[model samples]
Target: MWYLRRFLLRQPRSHALCPTSPSSSHAPSSSLPSSPLQCRTLSSTGGAGFYNFPPSAHYDLIVIGSGPAAQKCAIDSVKRGRRVAMIDKNSQMGGVCVHTGTIPSKTFREAVLHLTGYRHQGFYGKSTFTSSRRSSMNEILQRVQKVEDVEAEVTRHQMRRNGVHLVTGTARFLENGANDAHVKLAVLLTDPEQERKGIYKHREASLPKTLLTAEKVMIACGTRPVRQEETVFDGKRVFDSDQLLWGGIDRVPRSFIVVGAGVIGIEYASMINVLPGTNVTIIDPRPNLLGFADREVVDALMYSMRHYGARFVLGEKVGYPALASTSMEQGRRASCHMWGDFEAIPEHSMAAEQGGEVKSVLQQGGFLGRDTERLFPYGIYTIPEISMIGKTEEQLTAEKVPYEVGIANYKELAKGQMLGGMDGFLKLIFSTEDFRILGVHAIGEGATEIVHIGQVVMAAGGSVHYFVDAVFNFPTLAEAYNVAAHNGLKNMGINV
Candidate 1:
């Protein structure tokens, strides 16, 4: 193990994969330069001849996903002077965060807001300033594709800038040879040319494969949607989160039945409900939405969503939809389409969550182990966003902790009125004795951005008094902190 580690450290730090020599037909052309034997190999100089290697590249770290966690792992590892390589199954650079989950969905939401004129309903009146015209699916998706392309390119540039070798392929772990200290992986490489041209046409059996060895392996493979066995997903009539954006429904459906009232379902419902002539119904077995978030915040969100024409069916279960059009035919092979790179949908797709966890491990200089006690914030981007950090009232009650609530509505602020965020509000939960902020929950426009103020204070072990004493900008949503702080202090019998 020591011998192999030494050999890896001794190898040159060139990212160039094996250069295709005129004589060697097996080697493929890569952005990387050539090695001495025209094929890079890992061999131990001072050993009992225990391991003689094939033409395999070596790295100090290899990340399996290109999502946030994988990207952070690769970038952090390189900064620590370790040779890093990242392998993603997607033809594009960024993983689910950029392509399917975060960026695309959020971008779609923005496009919906702008195209539908949903953002100006308060100032212009709903009847008078309604959405002008129904935007074509291609028209709305065009912005999503543009944003995705820019983000993907940014990720690619970041990787190259940090010297993280980026490989576009599906990677599977190979059995560790005689040594357990080193890890081996068989990366099924995608065609570089096809990827460049925004096309992903080949099947797994046809793609080229490469063997890579690394000292440390980080599996940041994101998650895919959990499909119900009873449901037949036709992508058009019925679909999951991924299918919704990627070739599920070409045009926005006049009606949408969203099954789970979780974050993803609620977000989708909110976005789709705003579309002209669209009806969105969200159903869940749980009686309440966002069971983990603050009750008051959840109530506010329900009000806003309901006002916007979203229906909720809670504490009930429904059977799967009847078999829809012929098993949702696979999308056409990738080309220069309006959907851009999002057109090449994989048979199996993944979502996000592990990125932040992996990033925490790296930040604390800690190994991947049990999660630690930390202040984690949750954000749900419904039409009006919901974000919270620390303990909820329900959590505090469950733990039998004594606390008081401080509340501020967005309507009280000029900024909120100006932006038409009448339903938005911020809530603060603090200790009864010392007034230390225990939790913060917000629901409304910029709620995700607003909660960060509370997160920073709570992280620094600050309390509600900080917000009360601080002078925030006069016409900003941030001023709600000041209002809420005063309200909370009043509850605690502290007059200011």
Candidate 2:
């Protein structure tokens, strides 16, 4: 059905409604058509044809890809009474974030932790919990697959409930009209009947086509795993992150060589290291893993992973150019740092190396500096989770910022003993001059969740004194904050 030259016809006005007239600037306001703009049905030979259809649909906004960004945009537009349509190449409604990326990865992590009894390894002997048994790939992936299906269905329901038209196909941009009045898109439509019948099909030259013109177009195509140029990914011998999640391997390998020590690589390494008899070696050209995080927290995480049979090969590039994990802009500006230019924050390259500073600038714009925009927490989900907010000791020393440190080991706390993570601890850094909290770092169970307390405190310019004065729930991991605050105050020669 590629022939699309049926010319103009009238339909209900709501089929193509916009707040303002989009056809022409010279057309009278009253002359704007109150019905669907003329649309063309497709015939077998209409690939090159433009808006040559009978009256059909036109959207105020057309979003490409059904990832979180695209989904939010479409839903928000529909909420504002704007006609919206979303086109995704995949047959599934939600994009990679739902099927292969964040959701699936996190769910897979949970499944692994649960099935392998990783969390309980602290209480029971590691040998008793892990070395005793091995889980099959299908057993672990069953939960991941179920979670993905549910998430995808929920995303589909949300789109349908919100009245956002869902189109299954690949879309390409067409040349815009004069003055860019309307953006035209040519979409290669897939057969819904086949999808309904549960037949996995691929797009073919004979597939139907349609032309859609929108007042606005948004590109939300998600990301893919970076592959080394020299590495050929066969999804068996060597697999990228996407391939790993897409069920490429027959079983968890006895050994894994992850070529990048960034979050993804480290995460997969940690997940695999938890499996019985699995050895994971993480190789990165950069000398550090998660360089954007606090060095102490990262070190603690590395130590924990190492204790669990994971190996690291830093300062050696496998294939790709050694660049900072943060931004390309930061990389270009960081040539001064001979350590392979791994600067996370370009402006304060020496003061802070956390990427959250860049995120703060995007969310809160101004003449932003190191102090105002450098307070956000990041979590690395290794075997023993690590998370931190604000500046590191290295950053403070480089900036000549006077600070005092407070430390609290989880083993000293009843909750920590009960939870069985003895290596976990929370560290607090505060200004020596005013006792204002500068940073919060944690490595242990629930480290990510625990860091938020300090994030809220630092956001309000609260100091270590706040923790000392406030009472925390007894036997809770959160009490570590009070202990750390007191320790910091003690370090500063304050008796209280």
Candidate 3:
């Protein structure tokens, strides 16, 4: 631990790196301020390493991972006149957002809603529903690919135009001490045969190529779907969200059992149910869908989901092979866990008939909400999407902090009503003593986008009254801010 701390302290800091506090000061020698060109050309031959002269390339900043953060860092560095290198392992850049996560998922969701006549066509008939027309996976893939290609091209052109070098490679840290070492990135080259066959493959043809020696390294490697080793993804019945998005809708599972109830799970379940003849059973321990959402919004989501024929298994542990055990405590604890807390369930007990299948368990761990157990289907998207950048109610309770709660139903907002979405809402938790906003939770259409408003308020130590008095555009979803603030003031016995 001491060595690790020393190593971290010794590593070069970038100008773009935000300090934790405004008053915090760094030692002059702690940072290495060098031009990008100088950093790219800098070499250390005398250092102890397998490579004698530490590849001659240098960069003012080296961003590992081509995701949004990395791309932003590279772009910012270039704008600051620093030589930067943005690298990724994939054939194309833009990371998961452009590839599988945000852009593609949202796009697929839009397409699904459109094709299912969810957004419109209510005038045709009360039961007016289009036949489940599944879009071709190839078509969706091509559309995503085309958009990614265009984005990659634009990024590449912009970087080149601004003089930021883009490298394709895998990066690892060359440990010097705890924090005193530099990064080693090996650029992967394509094989001629694979290239000829029209398959994209990264073959280590020669010695690992080093494009840049960086004084600073930023790790922006976005996460991937984490599946259990014991339960192999069959690419059909059992799959991750990324595979679902890229693989196509033709293989839409009938009577599908989604192991998780987080954002991705709920979103997928919602999308699948929009398609005719597809039944989705979301098995999660949380009593409400989008548990991290505002309580009102979560209730609305649950209401919306019921209308879509989505099933939820709440407050119960789900295991494979249909077990008789109702709770996590009843299941036999096994050493070899496949996904989550895998307990053997009796085959006959499962709603879906399957033998020798393991049921994933969600042990209600005290994390976000009280009396809520954490269940199986722990996906990374669950963390960032549902509960990003805020203190949970559990945390606030643990700290014995005094807070005021403000609620706004987006249904009351003109924009939300205009969009035919009554589920959108925002929750603002603030300190009753000082009126400082403590946390913000939102859900529904544009929930993710609008949460930032509260985020800025809380981060800046602003008061709820600030939002109450602030003027918002008419017929906007953002009007929820003013409404929430007004509600909070009313709770405080203040007439606004």
Off-target runs (Cα >4 Å) in candidate 2 are: 1-56, 191-204, 319-375
Maximum-TM-score candidate: 1
Write one digit per residue (lDDT tens) for candidate 3, span 1-496. Answer: 0000000001111111122211111111344334332213223442221122123366656765555555655676666556777666554666655665556765666666655566553335314655435544454455566676787677667666777666544543432335535543333333334434545444333323433456566555454454433444444445566556545334444556666565555656666666666666666665655554345445556666677787777765445334221111111121120211122121111111111111101111112223222111111121112222355565677799987777888668878767655455677787889988877776566665677677677666799989978888787878888898889888889888
Query: Against the true structure, what is every candidate's RMSD?
Result: 11.8, 11.4, 15.0
Which candidate has the highest lDDT of all?
Answer: 1
Better of 1 and 3 by TM-score: 1
Reference-based TM-score, model 1:
0.79
Q: How accurate is candidate 3 locally (lDDT)?
A: 0.51
TM-score of every prediction relative to native: 0.79, 0.76, 0.64
